[model samples]
Target: MATRPPSLPTQMKAQFLDAFNTSYALRSVLLPTLTSAHDILIKVDAASYCHTDAVLGAGKMPPNPPSFPHVGCHEFAGTVVSIPPNFSSPSSFKVGDRVGVPGRAFHPCGACFECSSPEGPDADPPGYSVYCPHSKNNGISTDGGFREYAVVDSRQVAPIPEGMSAVDTAVLMCAGVTIYAALKRCGLIPGQRVGIMGCGGGLGHLGVQFAVAMGFKVTGVDNADAPLKLARSVARGATIVDAREQEASEVAVQVGQEDGKKDRGDMGLDAVIILPESQRAFDYGVGLLRNHGKCIVVSFPEQGFHLSSRDLVFRDISVMGSLVGSNKTLREMLEFATKHNVRASVRTLPLSKLNELVVEYHKGEGGKLVIDMALPDEQS
Candidate 1:
């Protein structure tokens, strides 16, 4: 049986992007209604600003650019306020349940090859529906959680763990899950050495914590002092490298020394996850990997990766790109985070401060910035 929904307002305040590279306009818009049977209305409690938001705003997301006047922000946490009467599937959520939505993909076309079940006994697992091309991307191509209320696909929502605030959950929805998935893609076992490039930024900070919690020996690489301090605070005994002062090769040697490797030739990390959008940072991360080591790219740079043939063929280094996690991975990550007490270090501000937050984001501020949607809008 579905739980009863509380009384909701017919109109609410929301922020919309009128054009590329323009500030978001706050306006009173009709509260979003359930357009699909699987849709659920949420009273947004918290939403976080992400680097992807900036990319989307800059019109850099090509192939399918976002329609103007689109609601921005893809990472959010809120309470379920309503569910469509004909909601599909066995509803795991009830009205008033705290939930967080992964904003990358929504309402995947179930008939596609990526969504179909494996055919043969040894068939590879079906790809994550989050990668389905037919799916809608919240904040990028569709409305997202930058308002007092939001309409989300029921299939994409995850239950917020007990004792976790909506602000923290909002951060986890994107930055947390993306970094965790990247680490998992590294395929390194416990006690293996892993390096996190840009370890003090939003995704980087969480990456450092998750890697340490997963029992890997972590080395945090960053160019700035603020993020380096953040990385050191969260990484415990892990090595912290300042890329501004040391070259990539020098950083690699430092990591090797810290790993207690006496043979200089054998010194290198098992894997390195690139979390910053800087091409230099990406190159530096690749340089830290040992022969046969994997380099995971999570950040998108305008110029793309500049890898030499030597880094690929001679070093036998493998490069992998990771997207935001699937629903299964999100659930597992939340569980692991809850069990290990891993949380994002966040600074909360009201929705009215979003524009300022975006500016701060471009200036390379450290830690996650989340909007407390429950706070009274100053403009209101």
Candidate 2:
């Protein structure tokens, strides 16, 4: 029998959101040349939709003004199909590597002060995925992880660590590393109490787990009356303190700590990770910290919070902003999350279902919604 010709490879598809044009379209786009820059070209087995991505899709996001028709999703985990022959970085792995690029501080000038900074480039203390002064985000300027394939710098790529799956690793780049880095900045010892102001979203849930794994007791606070069950699942043994004036549970800590003068612990509770998408969560987080306590703000809301200097001054509390964990931290974080077996509660949807999911996300509440490759095809 005659051999059939090899099947023609199809163009990759990406979820593009043109905010200025106000359109949500997922279509095939041209792949960039491999010799351009960077080491690995990844086949995205999993790409996660962060609240930041959703906000940007709706034109409510921040950072630089996105060039029109940007590809979507930054949190990524995938298999590396090719590595340039000239690739020389001593990364954990080379081609055929399964890796995660948690998206923060992955700017491309790399040599500039703001890009390199005192903190390690890519990730602080030496991590992956830095948005350098000259760098651009995936799916933002160039195509991002939303496509079937993404190419990133070896400096921005790290092995997904043993014991974690691609589905889980996708968020590890952004949401997972964000909280992990914040906790590290807090510099709390094992047993210090940490308050999570928004305890029930993608970032918040992971923050609770990471905090618990670091040996700090987490008190996850959320405005939702029905968050304990979900928070308990993530925090696992940590307290779920309702932000509302709900009478405290027998094992819960605060009944109305919001009303009371909740100051930082004497030895200090280390840091406070606030993931609320609202302004009040930040203000409330500041109130809960102890003297010299660190209130690390994780999310960016529509309007910045209105904080009082008096509250900051008298308490001797320090408010620090955290990006994500560094490449080194990403490696350490996988071990940390694995040792603790911290799993994210994810709702998987397809690329075609993205719009529906985003609408749902903006309206009601749910766990992390991961974009899987196996969606019902719409182009057919």
Candidate 3:
């Protein structure tokens, strides 16, 4: 017999938002009854901080953390603790079953509009549904995954592939799917060479793997020595370019080829995926691609940059932006992860440790931090 979910516990420890104007503080979770259909309860096992999380935690929001006093993560994986009323039966999952919910819900009604809309800016992110007026987002107005428990929409739940740990899967809920969806948007072909700029950071690492698994020849690009080594290790046989955008513009001129070759297999790059959150990186990605090649962009920066439409039109080079991927794409990502032993290198921390971790993260000291909500504070 399937095990029944434990009674909804009261007084959960949570990362609190004392005010709508401030960041999260460690506090207790309090709420009304969990028996309603609208009260879908989730025991957050793993919640990964996206770069967006950093900004929100800092209170840089048009409208702060959705509802104040809410958890602060969308890219998360957890077990179903309780289902609300309305349509609770035919349990999509039982208690203790491991599953991962993609970070966003684009669909509002039934089917997602992302599948129907022609791909463009006004179109919702690939995984969003028509109901998700606030598409391309999670934890925006809703309580996120930062707390020990969350009440995510049932429509948003998806399964994490069996045999993959929550730590590795957590990163996939957001970054992995974002890149996966981006590459899909580019419609890359087999044997095509793709360059992944910033190829070892939070999103870049996953991009490299996804490109590699999808049968593209991937070139991992980064400036740092440590991340470069990690990228090289994971993408064995793929080239590691020392070229950063700003650094590359100046330095590539200096590496004057011994054979007097300008292309030098670098400019011969077929496509480019810019994951770095900078305009320079976008420019460099465009430059690295072959004439007529595509540059798939995944990062968002404040300052807008420009490119010669003359260059784009004459060369037929395309610059396309990709947001988080669709639900189906996330499923594929997990299947690929399961098949190829793909895993996110995660440093597990306790939910209570978030205050410290967030500070460390901003200082550039952490790598893919995951909050293990179930870990006892004593063990942590």
Candidate 4:
């Protein structure tokens, strides 16, 4: 039933955050082992950096900050080295299967209203076990993918398609799924206009492609030249806007005129998906919506939103928040990504340069950065 590689080592190299506002310490730690019937042990091959890692490192995560000595990174892909002998799931995954874990919903409480459905978790529309408050987050609350080996909840892992690499799958685990789920929450049909507020950043660029693939007319809005260039390259037909060059109202008017709508009632986009962590981005995104349009908030800004009563009541604007996504959504996203050839632009560095990668992320690097665990330490 359960199998592992021959001569598996008892110890492995891992990066750990000793405390908030400190650097990640590289340490030799004991390899993680499967402890539950639903546990799957994976030998991690790649782990992608995320803004949440920076937030956690900087001690900005509110309410319950991650405990000390936590392993960073939530987006990772690897080969399954071991599975519980008594694995109790309708689906079957054996050792040696390539898989990716979405760290958002780990160990969801099956007794909750969101998890206890008559037709089961995989029912159409799926269960909202991702929203179960009692669930443990893989990277945030528990040891995660920064290590050579990780034990993930079997119920939350998805099999990687044959042609996809661990690096690409790692990016899709978080950034891809988050953006895809946010787009779905927009509730717009094909041919409708949608605005991606931070279209050039890690999630925004992917959002642009996914929106275009889904048959929506997209406006890629960002402040930097590089991201604008990236957005243009990815979605050729998208309307790329430089937020630094124009005010939110000005950009809104420009998008309206380009869409051939002169009337104020018909102007503006059907929905604006806010993907940046800037308050300005939030404000600007809200300004780009038409009457009765929706504003889907996916990024967490420290200051939060500053919405006026007019925008909510008079304009009939609906605001909603979306987290990473459920297992069903993850499968759909990966399938859609494969079919559409949607992928994240990523740069890879050896695991030894993880601290440097985090520093680069803080410097506002454009695209995703991944830690290639297989790389030799002397390579970089």
lDDT (CA) per prediction? 0.83, 0.68, 0.67, 0.84
Best by lDDT: 4
lDDT of 3 by residue, 1-380 (tens): 11124466665777766565465688775632344343356677888887777666556654434556656777888887765434454635545666676657723433445444525443444444523554434566666777777666555666877777777788788877787777777777987777888887777777777788888877777877766766776775566677633454343333324224476334445678888777766776776665677888776665546777965897788888877765556677788778977677677778888876676666543247788776666544
Candidate 4: regions farther than 4 A off: 1-6, 117-128
Candidate 3, overall lDDT? 0.67
lDDT of 4 by residue, 96-179 (tens): 999998786777777776666524333323343766678888888887899899988877888999899999999999999999
lDDT of 3 at 350: 88
lDDT of 1 by residue, 165-280 (tens): 89989999999889998999899999998999999999998888899989998988998878888888888778788988878778777778877888655678999998887788
Cα distance off (Å), candidate 2, residue 318: 1.6
- lDDT value, residue 143 of candidate 2: 59
Stretches of model 1 off by over 4 angstroms after superposition: 1-6, 117-128, 257-265
Better candidate number, 1 or 3, judged by TM-score: 1
lDDT-best of 1 and 2: 1
What ranking of all candidate models by TM-score puts the best one first? Answer: 4, 1, 2, 3
Query: For candidate 4, which ten residues in a row score worst on lDDT?
Result: 118-127
| Every model's TM-score | 0.93, 0.85, 0.83, 0.94
